[model samples]
Target: MKRSKKRIIKTIVFEILLIISSLLIFAPILLAIIMSIQPPEFVFSYPPKFLPRGFFVQNYIDAFKIVPFARMILNSALISIFITLGKLFTGSLSGYAYANFSFKGSKITFYVLFATLFIPAEIVLIVPLFRIISRLGWTNTYWAMTIPFLASATNTFLMQQHFKTIPKEFEDAARIDGATPMQYFTKVLLPLSRPIIAGAAIINFTYAWNMYLWPMIVAMEDRMKTVQVAINMIMNAESSNNWGIIMAATVVALLPTLILFFALQDLFVKSLVGSGVKG
Candidate 1:
């Protein structure tokens, strides 16, 4: 009875801590949103009010006028979707092969991929990458936005580890049913791998959406810029005091990722656990 009481108290304490921590983490985002809807006068008032005086949603309307907000958002979405799909498709296939099949030079190839794990993408052959993209006439184009970001070594490794947790019996059963390799992968493996797929998709989409420097370097055209880069441009173009509109733009930029996360939170959490699972 005493132990049960202690356990209850501990669980309650943990829940309280979680709530507090969540609120603390979310406070900044809340501030941005609240400030976004507030009048400029109240937003910059002395002592900086946490609660807005009133909701002035015109901030959002005004933000669109300041920049090509809609176009940039579309650009961000396009790049993120394509990159996420590419990563998931390639990651799963490479992972399945590494986890299930024994092939010549496969180990060596995998080890070479790990070399990227140590070297940061920022430092890895930027000059050559730019030159190649420029040569292909992909600079400032959708191809430039999507091509350089299609695959990730981290995604490959993660999918490989996640695939190892599945039973080989599933593969054997599919084979016994006369399924071709592609049919087995698509029909059997893909369906069962939803959790990891969701996780990878979310992660990759977020990464692609938030990319700043690469888009800035590659997409010189204002219409082709990603949301992050566009936001910076917006801020630079706006008067210093016009933060409300900027905040509103930020809120708009955050919607896709926020919606994606809330919608797929269960799968996202599962992906975290999936990463830790080994053969």
Candidate 2:
């Protein structure tokens, strides 16, 4: 009885500490959001106003006017969605095959793909990728933004680790019930793999949304550029005095990822543990 009580007390203490740490981490983000909506004078005020005063929404209006974020946001959404879905599909199939099947050169192929995680992307592929895209006439187009990153080694590694944790009996049972491999994969494994799927989607979506260097290189034209690139265009040495509009733009840019994470929060937490196990 005393041990149970001690454990409960320890758990409570841990949770309290965890909550405090989470709040501390989010403090800057919360402060930025508060500052974003405030009038310009209060932005540099001493002691700092931690709470929102009335709505000074002019910064947001000016942000849109100063930059064409509407089109950039839409482009980001479309590219991110495609990249996320493509990575999920490719990762799942490759992971499943590696975990379950044995075929000629399968081991070699898996090793090659896994090896890719180590090499710095810029050194090995950037020049060739640029040449290929230029030859394909995909520059300044959505295809240029989305296609190169469709396959991700990290996503495949996570899925492969997660799939290894499932029981072989599950596959045996499905086979005995006259189920084909594709049917078993689609109907049984994929359905139960929600945690990793959500994880991959969240991670890939955030990557695609926040991508900078490639988007800048590929989509040089204003209409084709992404939000991050657009943000850079909005802010430079000349715009140092207009920090309020920059903050407002940053806040608006953060909305989609924040909303997505909140919506899939449960799955996101599970993915952390799910990716680590191999049994």
Best by TM-score: 1
For model 2, the run of ten residues with the poorest summed lDDT: 236-245
Model 2, C-alpha of 206: deviation from truth (Å): 0.9
Candidate 1 Cα misplacement greater than 4 A, ranges: 277-279
131: Cα error in model 2, Å: 1.4
lDDT of 1 at 135: 92
**C-alpha lDDT score of every prediction, in listed order:** 0.88, 0.86
lDDT of 2 at 40: 77
Clashes of 2: 0
- Judge candidate 1 at residue 136 and give its lDDT: 96
**Distance from true location, Cα of 69 in model 2, Å:** 0.6
Return the TM-score for each candidate structure: 0.96, 0.93
Q: Relative to the unseen true structure, what is the C-alpha lDDT of residue 140 in candidate 2, on a scale of 0 to 100?
A: 93
